[model samples]
Target: MPPAPLLLLVFNRPSLTDRLFEAIQEHTERPIYIAADGPRADRPADIEACQGVRDLVLNRVAGRDVRLRFQPSNMGLANHIPSAISWAMEHEDRLIILEDDCVPLPGFIPFADELLERYQGHPSVAQISGSNYQNGISRTPCSYYFSGIPAIWGWATWKRAWKLYDRTMPGWDALRNTPWLSSLFHDPTHAHYWRTLFDDAAHPAKGSLESWAIPWTFNLWTHHQLAVTPDSNLITNTAQSAGTNSSGTSHRNMSPATGIEFPLRHPETVSRNEEADAYAMESFYLGSHPVERFFWRLRLPLRLAPLRRILRLARRHLTHPQPGA
Candidate 1:
């Protein structure tokens, strides 16, 4: 069977968009849809960059089965992406989604395609993610594992799943104030962090925040759904600073694009990996609180023998006081 159509979300980043588009061209021949959000009017160069990105797609992808959706005005990531995705889903039952910054490995296309078909109408399966943040630890024996945390670096979902996406977070008021909110996350810190995010997005009293993925994630969790992730990462998030909202960088969570050899090794049972999910909560979703960061710093020496040696030398120098003497 043919793979689901792919939808790409781009903004004023022609270089990154070109790299991603090339990756898609290298891997699969699935029908492609491109959505380019308009440039911010304040930035004089934005319009030129945005147009360059659109032209790059048009010129390079000429004669291919491609569709373009260019926004007339800047809708920002919050509005542009979800609306573009909804528009793409109207033409197909499922879609493989990518952002300008996300570059897929060779296996990513097939990996998402297979799982998209496998979990087609399964209400419990929320999304199929190509990115894995396990830091080389294989948490499950299966080729793919399940978790409630959805990774959007590279992913696929069905119309059924997308239909549940709530941008306004309609039931936020009741859910936000409930005791049950804390129970949803394994760690209280994560619960608090997510609550803050949901509260900000829902009310936006400061008019500074706007997003769709947080609400979409909340929708999936409320419905008790899981996302499937590969044992090895098949996608790379390359743009952490350039034209992106992602803050900070980590050695553990970021993986280089690597291929997954298939006819896929399917899991014997469909069950969520609680350990993996908790790790995601503690490690990725929630920034290390003061206590967690302290613990991590304490554990660093043990994890790295070189660091232990350096610390010991420093301690000995301080205790001996040889230089001052």
Candidate 2:
């Protein structure tokens, strides 16, 4: 049998799932896998989003081959996504991951396939992401430096790196003890949101969003893994609920590269677009509420005193976010 090249992890966002399927259908030759999260208990939104995901899995159109891994009940976002991805990836050497909120352009498939082969076992190559926050990154072309932030929109990864995937919060206290590692904390200029995020994840009465990404970043940082990206943005993220804790909000500038051209390319070196990385850290961590992400590039060795305090405050706030829409 041919190897499994792609895996689509869908929750209850049928609308977004439909858009994703439409994008995938545009180039439907690769093998596809769909993992649907079982319904959850405390969900507030209309489960209507999930229905579209179900439909896509059931109604496979012109794909080369497809498989479905459906959950019996809701497992919530954190469990559903990481579990589904780890499961699918366990079966393949490397696989691409797509969340429903992300919509891919035509070049997404070729972009992923080319990178999958290019970085098959390169230790430095952690994952191949498909979006570029840098507006002018395309001019340089080929591949660019690693972004601390990993994009779920139209992305691929190798299982060798997946082995480091720690679903359970491993070495939390130990993570804090590594002072030099503190430099990896998303720059203060970029926003110390991940610190706050992990804090919330640690709370007993909290939801799971903060837990997943924080640990994932920790994995990449500790191992010194590099994540490269294509010049043209491949996936679109439609999940920005805008406000902190997301209270049914909306805004513009939501889609960055809506229809940007994506092209396949040969191997090349790409440097860190620090300016763009700064922007992504701000938006992803601090929320798009105009709060800029912080950066402490000068704090080379990472003094444990201040880093500890910052991490503590972030945890406190994430667990009990300030009043906002």
Candidate 3:
């Protein structure tokens, strides 16, 4: 079967865009939609970098047809991303999404395409995420499992799902006061983590900090939609210091993007994988320990501070050469 339409989100990251586009060379015949945010006037280097990204995509990327949407001014993440995806869906029923930093494995596109078709009309299935952050734990007997979390490093969704996205998170006002929000998660701690995030994202005074994904995730959870995730990760995020939202380094930063075997094994049931979801909640979403969770809750604003400190310590350890070395 032909590949699904691909939508690539890029900004001032030509080198990363070049690398990611090279990985998509195998899909030379696939039509691609490239959405690039305008360079920030404050950052002079952004002008050249953004131009390089456009040049690379137009001249070098091996695709049959290319569509470009370059913003005139910096729309930032909150505005650029959803608008771009909406633009793509205007031409196609579904499209695979990849940021400049998300490098896909050989089977990532096909894996997403298969599931997107399988669950096209299934209201419960919100998306097909190419990321699986279970830390090598086998969460399913099938090739993929279901969860409420939608990892967007590399993912795909249909028009039906995208239509449900609320840019302003309209239900926050009603949901924030009720027990409905907490009941969605397995524990109060997870609920607290998400509630804090939702509150912050929709804060009237802090409106500028609003991002698109938190609202998308909120839309999924309120509707009780689940995302189909692979048993193993298929996309490795290589953003590092160049990441738009994230910085510093950690054990989870660069997991291998291993290819999936063809002829996937499908689960007979369509229910969410509770065990895997719990693992993600504890390991990736919330902290495993109560004390750690408390600190994480406290560190939301300064989350990157701890990561920077950890990276510094790691550099020191490496440079000093431990006793064994």
Candidate 4:
């Protein structure tokens, strides 16, 4: 069977959008759908930005199967992306998603193909993500590990799964006041961060997807599902530092993980690696915290170890084993 069509959400960044479109061109026989966010009239540059994207798509390779959805009005993030995804699902049973800033390794398409095929019927399977947090946990890889973070960047989902997506959250607001919901997702630190984000969105001046993905995470946990992936990250999040909302600081040297290994059979047993999972959550939370910034500065030398540099370099180079510090 043909792989699911790629659902692409594009906005202002023509440079990044150009690169991602080129990546899609590199793939074979995959249908592509472009959801171009409508232009904003009041903000002149934002209007120019959206116009630039339309120009970019028009010049690209066109197929009878290729499709586009152009909105006449700016819907912002909450509407543009979720609606774009919905449009894709309406046309196809499954979809692999991409934003303007997500660049894919060449292997990403094949890796997604393998997992989508493997887990099509697995009820416990929630979603497949191309990005994995590069936490050095168990060296023994068991396909992909379970994470509470339902990252939308470089992700794929079936219509059945996305049907559960709740952007206009009702239960979540009530749960935000409860510790039970807080503790279940773990890391009170990150929970508070999400709470703050949602609180900002409560009045709604703009879109907040971090708050939106919480429901998906909650549903996954309640069902005890797992997201499949290789030991390495297939997609690089290029948006963190470059775009509109940098969220304070940006990540540099963000390289896509190499070696997209495909597993033959899905692991029947689900084991929750508490330490690995907790460390993953804790690391992200503390890294963004002010005190930890000072702590990481104190340990900068240890963090910038020669070994760390070598592994980072080697992660992109399949030929070389990471050099010893």
TM-score for each candidate, following the candidate numbering: 0.84, 0.74, 0.85, 0.76
Give model 1's TM-score versus the native structure. Answer: 0.84
- C-alpha positional error of residue 200 in candidate 4 after TM-score superposition, expressed in Å: 4.8
- What CA RMSD would candidate 4 show? 9.1
User: Among these predicted structures, which one has the highest TM-score?
Assistant: 3
Model 4 — TM-score against the truth?
0.76
Per-residue lDDT over 165-209 for candidate 2, one digit per residue giving the tens place of the 0 to 100 score: 785546655665454344654455333344444444544242234
Off by over 4 Å in 4: 135-139, 177-179, 182-186, 195-211, 218-225, 241-256, 263-266, 285-325
lDDT score of model 3? 0.78
lDDT against the true structure, per candidate, is: 0.76, 0.59, 0.78, 0.63
Ranking by lDDT: 3, 1, 4, 2
Clashing pairs in 1: none
What's model 3's TM-score?
A: 0.85
The 10-residue segment with the lowest total lDDT in model 3: 245-254
Q: Give the lDDT of residue 242 in candidate 3.
A: 57
| Overall local distance difference test of candidate 1 | 0.76
lDDT of 1 at 245: 35
Runs in model 2 deviating more than 4 A are 1-4, 42-52, 61-64, 135-143, 185-191, 202-211, 241-255, 258-275, 291-325
Q: Write the per-residue lDDT of candidate 3 for residues 1-325, one digit (tens) a residue.
A: 4568999999888788888888787875778899999988787777888888888777875545888899977888878999999999999889899999899998998898888888889969989999887878888778998877888889999998999898778889888878886667657666766776677566634223436888899988878899999998899887553536332223343346666787999988788887887677767655333444445445444333343354456556666878987
